[model samples]
Each structure stands twice: as structure tokens, then as C-alpha cells.
Target: MSFRWVAGRIALAMLLAAGAQSTQAADFVDSAQRRVMLPERIGRVMPAGPTAEVLVFALAPDKLIGWTRPLSAAQQRFLPAKAAHLPVIGRLSGPYPTAGLDALRRLRPDVIVDAGPISAERSGFADAIQRQSGIPYIFVDDSIERMPLILRSLGTVLGVGDRAEDLAIYAEHAIDALRGRLLIRPPNERPKVYYGRRPDGLETALPGSPANEEIDEGGVINVAAGLGRDGRIAITPAQLRAWDPNIIIAEDRPFYDSLLHDPIWRTLDAVRYKRVYLAPSLPFGWIDDPPGVNRLIGLYWLSTVFYPDMTQEDLRTQVKEFYDKFYGDKLTDAQVESLMRYAEAKAGETRRVGGEPLVGIGAALPTPVPGPGGVGTGPAPNTGLGGLGLGPPGRRVPTGGMVPLAPPTPLH
Candidate 1:
């Protein structure tokens, strides 16, 4: 065949293939309000970032093509063997993308799922990727309150509606119950919380940022809200002192450790009053590193930390139940305890001021006392200890075995 003839034939074949794909695709509206032509039968899903990866894994582990990053030994212990061993494919969308166009072409995923805040920029990025790779891309809103809707919608698209509904209901109950408890105290009554990041504890998440979502929903005011919206920024010691928040939630273990002995930090009321708490990041960050569905558990944890008195359930049970349902791992009592050991309590210190016991310090107190914010009494009898338990038990997973990786087959 002539060179020109061969080139024409190749182009023709590509056109025909594109036409066939278009015919089989259906119009779907994503959370970004963009209309995307999604493949009718989506099998392999490419998660565009860490948030997308976690959301996809929670909804349909089998459909997920790969993880955005390799699972750590600690994370692998909490996940299913199949998921834990999945190859690490660099992310495609985010501040720093690692996945290249060649990688997407090789994977040839049925669809790309990007879960996070829906915005014009994200929609444009999805469009660009779709055009570049000739693959459909869908953005799902990962906002904490909108998670139920997102789960139900994405589940149906993935042919996992029943499972999605189960998770959605769980989320609904968790949110609703927590909201009811929050109604007990007005915004002023709630604590002023400062969420610190990094070893220096000077980096902080502002309002509308994913990192502070748990704190926003945790029935308290983010002291850093006045700084700005939607980004992590560094603050000076003067600014932190000016805010003088009643409670401090730190992301880095080293930062949390320093709060105990650092003189500069000791000047803050949160440190002096013993209201500083460390956020757990084992299998995943409890508050937000990826800002995914893992934060459903964070809502409960933060509530206990913010308002221990309003907590209604046991923290340890909640942790086990959340892990089994979302992570597919039935944690041993020891493992669960390890995750929560440093959350609310210190090893040797039961925080007290002048021989008077304070609330949510370390050990539980027989009588209710004023909490750090001076808003309410201590945690209810047997309620949250170390920010583990809060709110009512919605659903319980059967113990003594691994949680089923996939949802049960629905009855016709």
C-alpha cells in the first residue's frame, strides 16, 4: 500500500472506533453540573486524585483500577488485601499531578472519577483530560453534608446502588444525630477551635478548606476562619495568640507533642487548659489529608472533642464499626485502641488545674465539670473518651470476621 493510503486507513479506523464509543455512551450530569457522556458499562475506574481514589475504593473497590499512592504498612493493615496490593498509579488532577497522558492511555480506564469540591476549574480540568485521553471523566462532590447524595448517585452509576444506599443511610444518620446534638448549643456556646498542621503547628487550614471540614461540622467555630477561605496558610504566633481559641486540633504528631512543653505554645489557653488534641492519621487522616469519605468518622470524633458532654455512644465501638463498614477491615481491639490511644488522653497526664479536675483531659471524672470552652459540663457518663465516641449508634456490623468487600447481592 502507498504511504498516503496507509495513513488514511489508520485515520478511518480511529474515526470508526470513536463513533462506536460515542454510540454506546450515555449523557450523565456530574456534580460539577457538567454534562459528560459516560460509558454505559463502567468497569475499570481511574481515580484522578487521592480524594477520588478513597471515594471510589469505598464505593467499589473492584472497579478501582489502582491507588493514587502506595498504601503504607499501617494503611494496608486496615484495608482489604486486594485493595492494599493494587499498583500505585500517580494522580492525574490536583495541585501536583503525577500521572501522565501515556499512563492514562495504557490503563484505558472506562471512566475517570475525580471527587472533591466542584468548581469551574475542576470541570475544565476534567474536560481537558477527557479530550486528551478520549476517556469520560466525572466529578463527584465530596462535601461532607452532600456525601449521601454523592454516594447514592455514584453507586447507581457504578452498578452498586444497594451498597451505596447502605453507606448513604449511615452518613445521613451520623450527620442528623450530630446536628441534633449541636442544636443544644448555639455557635457562641460551642468552642472556638484552631486546627494546626505541620510540625511547627503554625500551618493551619482556613474555612472552606477540606482540612477544616471536620472542625466546621464538629459543632464549633474555626478560629482561623477570619484569615480567609479555602487554603492552608502559615500563621504567626501573634495571630494564634490573638485568636486564643479554646481548643486546638493538631495534624502532626510532632506538633501535638511540642504543644505540651513549648513555652511559646504554652501561652495559648488551649495548651494551658489541656484542650489540645491530636488528630489520628493511620489508614487515613481522620480529619482530612485527602478530604474523602473517611471524614464521616471524623464528624463523630470532632464532636466528642468539641463537646464531650453531648456524646451518646462509646468511642471504641464507633471506631471498630466505622472501620469495618468503610475500610473492610475488622480491627482487633488492640488495633482500635492504638488508633485512639493519643486522641484524647496522654499517657501519664490527667489534665488538672490547681487540683480541680477538667473535662475531656484524660481520665473520666465522676462528676460533670466545666469543659475548656466553659460552655457545658463534661462528657456524659461513659460517653466520648479521647474524641473516639460521640452520637448514637446508627448501624452495627457483625463482628468476628472481615467485613464483606462488596455489598450483598440484592433480591429481585
Candidate 2:
């Protein structure tokens, strides 16, 4: 070999070594400003929580290794075949941390992605996890207002820029439209709304709580704001009566159903006038169990409930589009009907508000009167109502491909 050829080979080797070093040291600064040196190609991703799981799944399902929690038979219907079957790897954060360092190492994920409020404590937690697991961990801000930006940022980190941009744009449009609508109506003119959680209807997302963002962004005043509390709080029926909201949205179907029969709840103007609405929680909670991108659909749905006159888009169309795009499920007419089964007030319950009858889907079925036990036994399945055969209050009957539905349980 010539001297010149050997010199050229040595130079090329040094250049390749430098390139490898650069790629190896490439760092991604997360929303918390913690610098994470990620792998050049992140193939397997483990979400730190449900919020991160949903966000990452939206951008790249193939890259997501597993779910933070197991999917119910019903929720599986709304997800991609592969995603629905992903093993339950447990969670890494929150009050209950199930995925230990051992599980993390066994999973061998390229990185751990967590999306939520970025704070010093959470940042330090990420640092600890990264150190213990010997895997790159990133914390991305999960604020509702910053969703578009978050999607784009996380997309870049996950190497799905195009997909991320598409979702980011969708989020941007949705948020911008909400802001525009809110601008049209002053805060005082907006509906005073109560968001009831759990089966009893007393558990509520306090003002400024992440769970309450859907209601807050819907241009309404949260009646619970006066409670001066943070996060979920329980209040007495007397307190709810005193605040008597213009509209009531419940997370649990049973709670919303009970409102029509419970003497105290029935006396409230919201129920008396049939202004009670049930927030959908099929594949995910529309209002907020995990408080993630799933709530985007809720934002549009809320417009129809609070200001029906202003919303011109067909709600059914909007819902199908969202499910198809985000959840990767094409909802059938039957499935859609099942979703909206009790979303609006019952047919006969609609009392005139401003001399206009509130239009709702399905025939006026008999309201379920309470049994001897005081719990209202839901009316028998009405096959004629587009497969909306009622099984029980706050539950969906499994028919065809539809699975029985219930409120989102904790991630335990």
C-alpha cells in the first residue's frame, strides 16, 4: 500500500470516530430543562405515566413498548390492534410506582418519557429514575394550553416530526377556535358549570386543577371555584345547592343518572330543567381521568352543551374524526350511537330553556325509577335506539363489537 493511501485511511477512521462520539453525546433538553443524552434512534419507549403514554402513542404507536395500565375489553375497541394488546408494564411515577428499576431494565426501552407539569421535584424524580435505570428519561410539559408546542417538541425527540406536526396543527386549531369562541362571550355571560366526579356526584375537580381544564377552557365558570381548594375535593349536597349551577357535567354516568331521581339533585335547577350532561369516558375520559389529549374532543363537545346555538358542526362527525385520527379507531354508526347514548339529557327530560326545546337523539324512553334499594334500575335495552340497549346506569351493554363501558378507574 502506498503511504498516501494509508494516510487517507487513518484520516477517515478518525473522522468516523468523531462522528460516532457526536452521535453518542447528542443531548435532548426536555421541557423541564433537564438535558438527556438519548440514543440516536429511539426504538422502544416506556411512558412514565398515562399522560406520556397517550402522547407518545399518538405520535408513534410502533415505538411505544407497553401501556402504563392494562386496557379494558371496551377501550381496546378504540385502539390499534397492536396497541390494544401491548402488555401492561405498570407505571413509574405518581403515588403508586409499580414499574421498578428491574422492570425498566428488562423492558430495555430506549428512553422513558413523562408528560405533565414540569417542576423541580418532578425533574429531580426523572433524574433519579434515569440514574437508577441507566436509561434516558425526559420530562415534557403537559399543560393544555401548550399541547401544540408539546406535541411538536416530543415529536422531535421521538423522531416523528411529520406525525407530530400534523397532531400539533390539529391541537393548535382546536385551541385557537376555543379561544376565539371564548372571546365572543364574556366570562360572566358564560354558563356557571359544576363538574361532578365519582358515583355520588359530589367529588369534583377544583378550580385550577388539571382535571378541570376541559370545563375551564369551555368558556364557563366552574361553580366549585369558590371552594378555594386545589385538586379533587368532595363537597356536601347543601353546598352544591347553594352554588346551583347553570349546567352540570358529570364524569360518572351513574352520578348523572342519579341526578334525575335523587330528590335533592332533582330539586337543583340543573336537573329540574334537565341541564345535566354526562361526559363520555369510553376509550378514555373526555373530561379527564388521565387529563391528556383525549380531552380535546371534550372541548368541542362542551361548546354544543354550553352554547349550542354557536356550534354548527355535527357533533357525531367531530367525534368520529377525533377517534379515527387520535385513537386510530374508525367508529361505526352503532359505536358512535353507543358513545352518545346518554351524552345529552333524556328525551322527555328536556324542559324549555328560553322557550326552545333542547333536541336530543333517540326516542323518549321511560326514565328509570329507583328500585326498593334507592338505586335506579336503568330501563331495559331499547334495540330500536340504534343499539343503545341500556344495561345499567353509567354502563354500556356489549353488543356486536361494542364492549361494556364504565368510568376510568385509577392506574393502580
Instruction: For residue 25, give model 1's deviation from the true position in Å.
Output: 4.7
lDDT of each: 0.68, 0.67
300-412 in candidate 1: lDDT tens per residue? 77767776766778877888888888778888988987888778643322222222221211222323323346543323332211100112211111101011122222211
Model 1 stretches with alpha carbons more than 4 Å out: 1-25, 186-188, 345-412
Instruction: Tell me the TM-score of each prediction against the true structure.
Output: 0.77, 0.77
> What overall lDDT, based on C-alpha atoms, would model 2 receive against the true structure?
0.67
Which residue pairs in candidate 1 have backbone atoms (N, alpha carbon, C) closer than 3 angstroms, thus clashing?
Answer: 315-388, 315-389, 344-386
RMSD of each: 16.7, 16.6
Pairs in steric clash, model 2 = none
lDDT comparing candidate 1 with the true structure? 0.68
Candidate 2 lowest-lDDT run of ten:
395-404
